[model samples]
Target: MSDDLPTISFDEALPITAHVDQLRQALHDHQVLVVAGETGSGKTTQLPKICLLAGREHIGHTQPRRIAARSLAARIAEELGEPLGQTVGFQVRFARKHSEATRVTVMTDGILLAQIAHDRQLRRYDTLIIDEAHERSLNIDFLLGYLKQLLPRRPDLKVIITSATIDTARFAEHFDDAPVVEVSGRGYPVELWYRPVTDGDHLDAICTAITELGTRDGDILVFCSGEREIRDATDAIRAMDLRFTEVLPLYARLSAAEQHRVFTSHTGRRIVLATNVAETSLTVPGIRYVIDPGFARISRYSARTKVQRLPIEPISQASANQRAGRCGRLGPGICVRLYSEEDFTSRPEFTQPEILRTNLASVILQMADAGLGSISDFPFVEPPDTGQVTDGVRLLNELGAIHDGGRRDAVRLTQIGRRLARLPVDPRLGRMLLESDRLGCLRQVLPIVAGIAIPDVRERPAEHEAAADALHRRFWAPLGDDAEASADGSDIAALLRLWDYLRDQRRQLSGNGFRRRCRAEYLNFLRVREWQDLHSQLKQACTELGMHRNDAPADLAAIHTAVLAGLLSHIGLRDP
Candidate 1:
């Protein structure tokens, strides 16, 4: 090893190590290399070290979720025998932990996309690893397409795309038939037992499966579609009254302190109920049995209806396989699928790329701001439907983000669009901000926009739905109740009331007291804090852009007008 090279060690137990030399040689041979490693292949944690060994410095790696980036950074730094934020660090929204000495910086793919707006050439990184590309998120697809265009300009930059065995060929083909290195998993045999739900209740099926696996000697991992399902599953399993077992819930909305329970060592076996966030984005340890319900909340945007919806849909075969692979990590394991094998075989080979199903308005804004040509002409790995592209452009036009050039193919960003692109919120919310600036009510709109951009701060636990609802109603401004307080029957009024209440509470109460009060009020303290953080971030972005909030008293009418500018499409006429 050269004296300047960082001394790094790899766990021989991990299957990815077997192909280290091949990966190194491929890096030397090509600008882009695709690695098709299954879940538990240890590719996520070890790939950065391989890049370092290949003589690449200052690597930028992206994970789909903030938790994954932070956890993986900690794990990699520990493996390198250094403290976190020293050799390996991570940056997520509102959180950063990197120093001047950091060589490997892991961040969410969205963070990388945001960086592209400022650092067009990505001069900070010599090697970029797009991890879990098979997820095919909007940010990932945009990055893939952008990198494809950027590779020729920056021949010195090396790119590595890591994904499971699913759709690796398409990724390779996207990069001009880049060489692919396949790494086998840990080789633990995972037995799949199909347990289709005959009772029409998945919770019952999950409980029955848990009862059947009661004899099993390892921790159980149940895959639910969302937080609501997780909560229901946790209650269902608890109702079973299994002894010596702890039930835990995992999801993206969870606070860091709550998420830590899954990683910490405990005495009894645990039943971890989680969303698809666990499928590939996060890897929970000590999972020897997986109960997959074969359903997840998939985001889809309807161009005709102009609505964005998250519906519970069947998981593709690739996602099912990823869930099953989670258990085989520790040892020989079993996966009890709550759907028929024939159903699995009949499902799609892969989930639809988010680019195809999602609203492309934000994406179009991003591309336009990057000076990329029309959305139709951008080199997406899988080109989106032309109608969807038109809808995106139309939405941008509606928001005054883009203006048509004399030529039909020429799509240009307006000043409003450039400002919208600079703010990290949705284009609709960004439009609301701009309108607020015009209405002289940015102070009132900033928090509402940030609140809409995040998961709701009010949490209704399954067990205390009524209590939560009643407490939440305290913030509601009903019709004819208070002339000054009501926001013309707009839900934004409720949000403002809640924000005001929280702000008042925060001022008077200590940190711990505020958190306790939030809990008593059935509000997610972390989410409330996140709301505040985002508001602060938006405030700072506005300041930098020279947009100022008003000092006048709150005006519900002007606020409603400002909010309506962004939601014109959502308004409907009622027939009398």
Candidate 2:
């Protein structure tokens, strides 16, 4: 918005800037524009600025990640010769620094959906840009459907959907054939090597290949599907101690500080082990080699069991291409794929839309809060499973967030339900936190509830089986009356003694004991922080409700009942 800002160069040797300009013009003329560009194109970074400079109005861009939103905002602001959050700002969960003068705001798609819940029409901005539509996340898909219904009504609003490998024709047909603009990305020669795994090797073969490759000068990026594989691969590489390699793990579970380490430059040759999160939304600097495991962890929802399972599956061809493009960012590079060429030929061209696989409860709650009625009538690029939709409605009804008996023709939230939705937590955890007040065990119950909902707090050392078991024992609550016995007399004392032993062992012997305590367990630090935060919030809520914050613990039955209020759905029985 400021003319005094430094002139940014659009004079890149790439010919895509013309397409960017064309897309910008189309955005100006029509209320919606769909732009398709290949991987490595400057579209994600450059196009928003084009819109900002051309429109002289506020613009909002949504990314699928907090890291991507923040980093991309900083990069674009740097190019404009302005500090981040001055002209370009970003918002993620628990962090925001946007001002009235800010012309462009970038945020995760979830944040945008949260915003829409409060302000249904998103009246704050004149233009909205949805980046990475090809990801087909439930939130992104819902936003697309909502915006399609919104465009004709809000004539002044301009929308742009950007994706690298999206089927433009399909998207165009979805949007009633919105103007489609294709942009060619900067091309680089990349050599692809496909190696099929035999019976002897699993993912460990990747580390062996890296070691055999021997002292590559540039950064190495390895793509796996989940945090477990990333951590396992990183540990294996560290065990090998390949000279001059700075091993770093990248995944969503890491704290913001830890995630930032992967983006910063390193002195020695770097090896970044990451999930599919790094495949599309992020751009890591100085990568020259890519190791593709060809598998990603996908969250699948089961309507019959009403459970969500995270499993590893082969990635789509589009995802593989994006992984390959990581190597070519600087110049010509090599992609070492761990699957056979024939396997690659048989893989699906594009990943399935997340709307089809994930739990639709949250999306349904959001739509109900926004007065979107049942999600079935909402126009989606790919509609979710009918059973999943029914399951979502049933869950909402069970939670009292919606009152649609068996049919989901109409829905409304209760007062208690509205408060639960306001909390930035899963509905179950939110319900648990709220119930802590009525049960009068706000202190102890809130922390455990939050802990369960947050990431795990235990950290296990690699292959330390004994240590992992010890950590689990330290944290695990005893079953039935045994839990009560532990809470009573010498059980607490015995637990304290175990903690002391762990503390002492951690102090000495390089915390191998502590690592051993967590080896088999999936402990995460963020979950611990969330627990702490939940405790603080529950205390605050208690004070607001006229309950004493420092009251003594209530009856254990009440505490368990409060926990059951939220965790009823999570309850399971074991067979004898």
Candidate 3:
């Protein structure tokens, strides 16, 4: 077995060596452990294989994002001299290319949760590695809490929690004093400069800083709160006096090709304006300068309104540190913070865990699906407010996703709920997709659902907003809300038209006109691809439900209501 093992070289720094040994020993000793390391540390890529070698069995690693899972798997495979999906495989919500013989499988945390729902024991893997635990995503937190209860029952299961910069003491306490191992990162010294900001100068200040940095060597990474800011900053940067810099805007919305450009190196200076997506999961290879706007868009659950709001808030110190560390990955760098040092000192140490922030409907559904009884009793590093838990159960009950009653007080998923969970979309959109299928509007409803789930795909030229609006209206069926639009009026046609226009313009434009179109329309080409994948998945769900394609008018009202079912908390009633 040792002879068959592939040999690979890594930086032999003290921290890397120590962390590798700790991970190796953890698998050797206890069946569960948590490894805490900052971003730019090699743990994300390196630790799993160390366990694979030490234990002589396949290792399963979970990531928060599909792109990160696939990219990291490919990089690890390359280092191990194995072809993609051979020794290393990856599985996301809609895509999977793994084999029984695969030594390591890297997948999204949601996928892992789905697997656990199917197989409570996770008997297939000898070791389970949960990466990016600090993100504290709904799935990650649930997995951690669930697995803690699972460890004693399945002593054979070895679990590893890998995080960037999290409060490990809390995690250790949650795991009942699971030994905590720390690893030093490879980040270089980054000069920090806090620039004072006026009330509305967020975009201007970031652009100005990027323009100043563009004159120097290396690429620039500007962090913003969301897609809107990313687009605004990208446009502002291009409009600035940095004619020499090639501006590339990156976010979850960009098409895979566009997002990939941020990672690609260019001859001239490249400026990447992105959202929080870049902070931890992704490592842009050549970024040497970082512009942090000090704000990030966080999805919050409003108990008062019982709604989910994507409000911009000051980033936690951990996130700020992660953003700054991006600059120092390759070499010495500079991080120009948009806020004063006073703001930094006052920031929260880490982000509020996802349990506290997000509408917990899906989380409750997931917990119910996982047979984790009553989320209130589940062990969390930081238990959510009872009001939030009550809201989650109530929301799930209203959506008809869970049956709520009994002496056990257990929540169980309905048949529709199971279908909803499998749709690779928000529970609300999943309900809409299922209902649309039943209504024979899969073709029409699927694309719209995809569009709503993916907001960064509507591309338009800065000057051609009128044209983009025209195209959008072309797909906007004038028929009543209850009427189904023709296939030509569907969102698929709109996306195809936009994609065709982008391809044509890419061939014709010399300046940043193509990017300007993307920015103006709030589109990310990569997000369109993600939407397409989502559309395909919904279609598969339709087929699984035995719904056939037909020309019949879909129950548009029912589909809308189904979407509203899961999104009831997010709904805004208009004055009648």
Candidate 4:
């Protein structure tokens, strides 16, 4: 590490930094401490430093998001006067960074939990920090329970749970009344304005307010429910005559570089239209104002429907506060709520945990494999509904992961169930991959799995969906005299063909030539690159699992056979 650390620009000491002694002493006194701090409190980045200063050399930190983990690792590395991958590193799915000298490790909660399967003691680290505990996902819940069990054995190991103000009580109680330490966040005043949602278009309100805000000093951030809202709002804003602004869309489906555009310190006015992802974990710099549409897609699993129901509903007051705080991170700002104050008051105090709303099939499998015993006995901070638990077990039994353990309702993993849990992909996709070898189609299924696992490469604009679809067909259309591809004429065949085409040209031509081919085909080049990375990881996983590898493509039926075999339970017919 060099003496010249990254330059510090903020003159105002963050709330966390002001209480270093109290935080450090609290960590020393308690085995588990809950740190409740709001956004801009500097707990996420500064806590690692406090851990280091407190002599916990090896710090294991888990974040709820990959982007947040990577970005935060970079920030901390810079602050520590060390290059990334040296002192600070992050590990996420299919991507990782670190060295033997790495002291502080940041990773997604999933990766951290995955570590438990191999390292029961977690001897590599002395302290473990779970950030973003407020948004209680399944991985976080399972990890918390597992860690609670492991702590007694590793008596020297320390644990710290950091969360926003919403769920401090639950976390503290979950750890058997772990001491809670609260830090007040940045105190800049944010002026709140209200406009109730009307029967008219919401994009109009977003556009008009943003255009008006663009005329003033700093950037404007607009929060939407989904990608459709993002696109419509972007188009409406671009259609306006704002000469000094750059309108960008931030969503989960966007490429990492495209998402980085929202964080880039541009010289001109920037308007970021994003989903609830921007509500927490990420801080967009130079945001002087925030516009909230007050609605977001909330997932509700239906046992009867056997699928997730993603309905657009009003955001809770906690989310609204989170959105407004984005503008006040660096300075005083304004928050424009596109809903009435009465409606805001009617919303829930906190958004329900995702573990409750989502299907628990995957979580149950991991828990069963992790020796958590059973879903009903799992120590979740907030237990999911009994219906969700029953549905999860039903699906697992259907997949043959669990069979009757001889008792009335007891279940155990079959041989295939153990293998399914070993695979990193979802159970359905894992089944397809395993069966592909039997059908002589491992090669074909690999690319299709990659496609499902990554973002969609075909970018469809709302205004140009038809044109985009036609352009995509150019690549999907069958090649001449190819019997394997034309066997079923399925869309899966086209996706495989596209992957083959990209790989073929890369072998025959230069990098630029392959990129040109992708552009002419209306493909997202970055997504193609991501797919290649995922494909490589899949191949590695298969090889490690002692599966035979096929170096050549298989016939179309072989691929479709495997895909349809896995999706048999999901197939349903609906009336037109």
Candidate 5:
């Protein structure tokens, strides 16, 4: 007879070897465990195995980003020697994998947060592992707060907070002094050296350093602030005659296929010019050196503008440390800072949590719908700015989430607001969705609203930019290049028309055939599938809200009216 439980066959040894037993015992004894370790200290990969061995048959592990969650799940599933969607699975927005017999599941934090609204007890699993908690993303903060409240009610559940070793005290303190199991003495030593330039010519300084370091034996990683810097740096490196060196870029806006190049194993020296996405979310292979300019684009809520602003600022001490750790992943490495050590030390110790730096309108709506009182009194790990919270409420009111009762104290989700909160969209888009039904244009506007929320599905390869633009222009017949279909000349009609064409094309073929069709047309097949899924979900949500009724097909005028009705506040005038 064969044993049913899966096991990991080791080729060599992993870093978690020395610490697995302690982690197992800790999980067995405590309801909450904070696992702290450096990058490649094996916390992300090893903790799940320890939990399984400690007898957690079902686990829900959360990651900060969708790609990280999917990749981690695949890695773990392979190690377990099971089919990808059988014993282990992953769920992100518009994608899900799992079976009734699955033992472990990996999902993005947003997926878990949405689950909390339906399953407050989180009855799906006995264990919950929230990875990368130190990043303090908005979803991470909300999940931490949600679990903190749900723990007492369901005392049997296990919660583990994991991050690269930076600060665990705050996380521990937040959970009634949860015991922390530290995994140390694993990561390779990385030497840190600082180089500063008073001249603002970063492009010249970076190229010069890389040219000098070309004689080095290992690959390099350069951290930049944004896309423009990445482009400039990449162009500068390619212009050099450094033999057998390849430069690649990584940022959020890149296509999935384009981003995969950064992780590809190279025969020659590889230098990755990247944004902060490479800082902690991913581990690019063979990076033996790091070049940090000590800056990142950080989002901060501006009370004056009543919106979140992305400004390039100096990296925090913790972020700088994380960037340095990227080099020492495989062996002893070197990290060169483009900023002075004194300047690095002067930055903040850790980044402010997302709760304090983001627009809170969505969370505010969720809290009100969940019966958590005024945003002023919600239990946040880090309190948001009061003025910003006030601004969020005012915005929600504008979207009709709050009653227009003229009384300050009387605030709650209206009937329309309840329906708005049901779908996973911003209140403004939600308003547009709900208003479409009344405007007699729900069917016509549904795909357009969903398409607006995602990145474009069309791929424009740089080598063939003009050709790609021409290919995209093929779909611009009805909307034209000017894309005017109504009085305001909104591009939404174009989006809807594109979605309509794709929908008809999809219905004419099988899954593989449709994918082949998209490739032939130079479109991102995956994103098109995601758009279809979003449309289905929104349609079902509307049906649940009792807003789905067979009405006359709406014309372009009504569709424009619906969009404008929801966006009246955003219209602005410029002086002539």
Candidate 6:
């Protein structure tokens, strides 16, 4: 232990604080311990410190989201009175902040999985904490399964699984019935009001609820289904011109500066419209009221079609309760559900694990790349269906990622698979990059592949949809001697053209100027930044793999060929 360690103080009011000795001992006596702490229990920030105090050297804490990872690392570092990246640091996609002196590393679960390639044994950390395990995301389930296999080999390693109060026993039982320490939340009373939406319009209901709550004491947290809902509700609420209330939006894709504003002090009351990201991954401060619309866009994959679908559906009962609990942290609070109690009771008890719901191709490819044995043998908390596993393997084979081993389940990474595994992209996008390399059009295809990874950068404001579309049409590739112009009516061509235009503008303008240009052109500035960041990361990965850019000019046919390699299954025949 360092002699100059900052004097640490625990907030006695936190429920998790009371379990310090018990948690520390649990860690000491057991190789794996499960912690079930509700929202506001301080478990997310405090558990890592407990690991450090238990004499654990380096700690690796995994969060389900990048925002949560970054925010939690900052909070923990602040609490330690140490500069960020010194005592506590975070690593998310395309962003890393950590130094040699750092003892705790907070990272998205995907980042940790990526580390499995370089650190197969995860030997750098003496302890690993998987936070938000109750979310049951695909990555968390895979990490849990991976750790289950790894624990026996690395007996000295300590694993702490933390989740909300829901379904903690299953996690404990998964780890051979590891001891579970349940901690209560802030003991504040929250009155639930079931105001079922008589009409299907959530915006009207949210606006009506806001009108009712505006006269109250503290900030209001409204849970919208997704970003569009947040934007729509923000507009609707602002239209009402509520007196002295600040309307804000919170979601995963918002810029760091925008997200910081939600936490900053504000006058009067603040109305925050957010996605499920706020449900458990983040805690917006000073929320004395909650508005639950009872719906969220849940990602479900159709193995038959091999398409990932994000459809707005009623939230599970566990999720609904989690959203309601957000308000109770600050004294007495009220939660007005936009749905009736009968509707809430009709929903599922808990959410289906993402492993069961999402495409398993990426997970299978990663496992094959790491030589983690067959996916079938992997010890997930709930193993995916056999057909889904088979479909995943088949997709890899179609992408030339797996060798023709004459076995449906046998997974052996081919040369192409090896390169695909090196890049931190979806297997489909990885295949496109490989195809681009072979077609000598990596430069043209790089942006398109990266663009496909994120939401479209083009923005069409509701009020200016026509103008936005007209301005957006400026990027369409010209057809010889034709008055009508399009990207040959291909989405890939449009992406390339927009990417080229943005790159040119970026070269001519300052950073702020480029952002202004994006706004003027109705492009999603944050999404553009995300596209650039992901592209840069992919480029760096390609360079490291000795795949240099081709100096050839733009090749339309070659670009389409490269793209086609990734979308063979997506092609359909149109009947005239």
RMSD of every candidate to native, in Å, equals 7.4, 6.9, 7.7, 8.4, 10.2, 7.0
Candidate 3 or 4, higher lDDT? 4
Stretches off by above 4 angstroms in model 4 are 1-12, 197-200, 227-232, 252-261, 309-312, 369-371, 385-391, 403-576
Q: What is the TM-score (0 to 1) of candidate 5?
A: 0.70
lDDT of 3: 0.71
Clashing pairs counted in every model: 0, 8, 12, 0, 0, 0
Q: For each candidate, what TM-score against the reference?
A: 0.75, 0.74, 0.74, 0.72, 0.70, 0.76
Winner on TM-score between 2 and 4 is: 2
Model 2 agreement with the true structure over 1-576: per-residue lDDT tens digits: 467445756747545677656766787787778888776577788887788767547788999988788778887888888888787889987688777668889999988887876777888878999998888887788789988888887888888888875687777888888988888666678889887777323456797669655776788999875555566577778888777778889876577778888878679899998877778888787889999878875656545545443445688888898899889867889899888999998999988887676667766766676566567788888876777677677777777676647365566777666666565445665566677676676665655554454334555657775766564564344333344346443322333333344345446743233344433344432232233444455556545545443378566567667667865776789799
Output the worst ten-in-a-row residue range by lDDT, candidate 3.
Answer: 478-487
lDDT of 4: 0.77
In model 6, which residue pairs have backbone atoms overlapping below 3 Å? none
Backbone clash pairs for candidate 5 read none
Model 5 misplaced stretches (Cα beyond 4 Å): 9-14, 197-201, 227-232, 252-261, 366-377, 385-391, 405-411, 414-576
| Index of the highest-TM-score prediction | 6
For 521-559, candidate 5 gives per-residue lDDT tens digits of 778764675567567667877876777644676788888
Q: Candidate 4, residues 117-208: lDDT per residue as tens digits?
A: 67879898899999988888777888888877778898899999999888698889888899999986656789998876584457678876
How much does candidate 2 score in TM-score? 0.74
Candidate 3 per-residue C-alpha lDDT over 1-576 given as tens digits, one digit per residue, 9 for 90 to 100: 456567755666525665666567766887667787777777887886787668547688998887688778877888788887877889886677777668889999888787876788888887889988889888888888888878888877788888765677777778778887778666689999899787445766886676566477888888876665566567677777576678887665456566666656578778887777788887777789999988875656555544444445789998998899889877899999998999899988888888777667666766777676777788877777776567666766666787755212577888887666554445666666666666666666666665565444655768777877655554345322322434445444454444445556657963346555655555554354445555665567677666665677555565465455556667787799
Global local distance difference test of model 5: 0.76
Give the TM-score comparing model 1 with the true structure, all chains together. 0.75
lDDT per prediction? 0.84, 0.71, 0.71, 0.77, 0.76, 0.83
TM-score of 3: 0.74
